[model samples]
Target: MLNQIPLEHILLLSAVLFSLGILAVITKRHAVVVLMGIELIFNAANLNLVAFSRHDPQLMQGQLFSLFVIIIAAAEAAVALAIVLRVYQHFNTANLNQIVTSED
Candidate 1:
């Protein structure tokens, strides 16, 4: 039932989503928006992995690895957010440029 949709459609959507993710990363300067972009990228990767898994039934590695990737990404996001919060507390700003200084 799930195979009713064409692979081309799936690939196209994945490409669009991936491009949007790249755009988000490039356009957003806020730390949280950057994190959201990373999440989008991770989601696109998972979608591709699942699509490929559908093609090759003999190996479920892609799906499994994707799950691990999601887990790692979540952990990374948590740690990153924590660090961002600390930076904000210390510097009172989340802008990347504001955090940098020639003195440092």
Candidate 2:
């Protein structure tokens, strides 16, 4: 069933996901939303990797790389969320623009 779908279609979907992720990251101010955008970008890359890997089932390099990316993304989310929590405790807000530091 997967072979019937053209690579171009999968690539197009991935591109759209990437674009949306970029837009979210650039336009949203909430830290959680930004993290979600980052996840979207990671997912887009994973989709491309898996799509290409489907063509050659023997090598499986793309799938392996995608798995690594997933692991890194999970760790990143944990660390980033922890940082965001600390920032919120200090600033009382999660909006990036609203968080400011005193020079003193």
TM-score of each model, paired residue for residue: 0.88, 0.91
Residue-level lDDT tens digits of model 2 in 1-104: 44478999999999999999999999999999999999999999999999999889899999999999999999999999999999889888898878754321
Worst 10 residues of 1 by lDDT: 95-104
Where model 2 places Cα greater than 4 Å from the true spot, the runs are 1-3, 101-104
For residue 60, what is the lDDT in candidate 2?
93
Question: How much is 26 displaced in model 1, in angstroms?
Answer: 1.3
lDDT of each: 0.85, 0.93
Clashing pairs in 1: none
| lDDT of each residue in 1-104, candidate 1, tens digit only | 54466778878888888888899889877888888888888888888888888788899998999999999999999999999999889878888767885133
Show where candidate 1 strays beyond 4 Å: 101-104
